[model samples]
Target: MSWLGVQNLGSRKFTCGHCGNIVASSAGYTRNGSNQRIYICSHCGQPTHFDVNYQYPDIAPGNDVQHLPEDIEGLYKEARNCVAASSYTGSVLISRKLLMNIAVREGAEEGKPFIYYVTYLADKGYVPPNGRGWVDHIRKKGNEATHEIASMSKSDAEELIAFLEMLMKFIYEFPNKIPC
Candidate 1:
């Protein structure tokens, strides 16, 4: 109402929370006099909303695993995509599955309990002694996710993704990069 004359500006750029695409959003005033910005994704057509002063949340695309095997890379990408979509539970589940895949690929016995896979990785020297604790933490969260006991928060999901990225790099990427 000052120099601009209009209380709300018309349109602004924002990333769609539903579809994760950047697009222009039109502004409208809510009944409470707050300005709400809305945008529809061009590709997915998902309507996203934001307050006038709200900043778009940064989307984390997760880690690069081009060197990983196809199955492992697919699972990792799915987990990352879940994070980007705010589906923390899905991310956790996929991450847990990814860990099992890693264990199997590293010669752990198939059809064993989740803890066996984790312990096998530690006992066989695939993962460091300290890494067992981190793996167990992931396993516990993954259990919560699988059993639907509780949902995961974004921060927890992000932390899990970070840990998985480090583990995958240690198990797959780093070794392949080293000169034999």
Candidate 2:
């Protein structure tokens, strides 16, 4: 790959798909016989390819929540990463598992069926008012991703992750802000 000493890709700020940090992109290069321009990440030194108007390894959505258990946090981050990496089904599956983990951490019994965790969370009010419907939707989407021929779409994963973010913030982050 010869670095053609010219920036075909204009200077721009980007979220490094590899590192997840926002950085002013390094110089862009075009290889011989290829139409795409490649720019290296300033933060991670990983290269991001630009073809027409698209990027390789699209930036993942979602951010870390405070006061979350290590395992749950890892799973949450992994789910977001999966979505960013085009693993929509995997993200949904991980989000499903995350619901169970959250329920157990919030005092629900372990080793129960998936629905048990959902019901437990809802019964105990961990799902908040009027949130049961979407909670059930998450479970249903997860089931489809797991058992059905239909794979999840990017929007589906994004929607689930968005809900999970809010739920976690409510159940874990916001509550912990009070005096002990």
Q: Which candidate number maximizes TM-score?
A: 2
lDDT of 1 by residue, 35-70 (tens): 554444555766554556553333655558647889
Task: Write the residue-wise lDDT of candidate 2 on 1-180 in tens digits.
Answer: 565865646676778788988888757788777767788887788888777667777788877799998989999999999987889999999999999899999898889889998899899988889999888998999989989998899999999999999899989999999998
lDDT of 1: 0.74
As a whole number from 0 to 100, the lDDT of residue 127 in candidate 2 is 85
Cα-based lDDT for every prediction = 0.74, 0.87
Give the Å shift of residue 108 in candidate 1: 1.5
TM-score for each candidate, following the candidate numbering:
0.71, 0.89
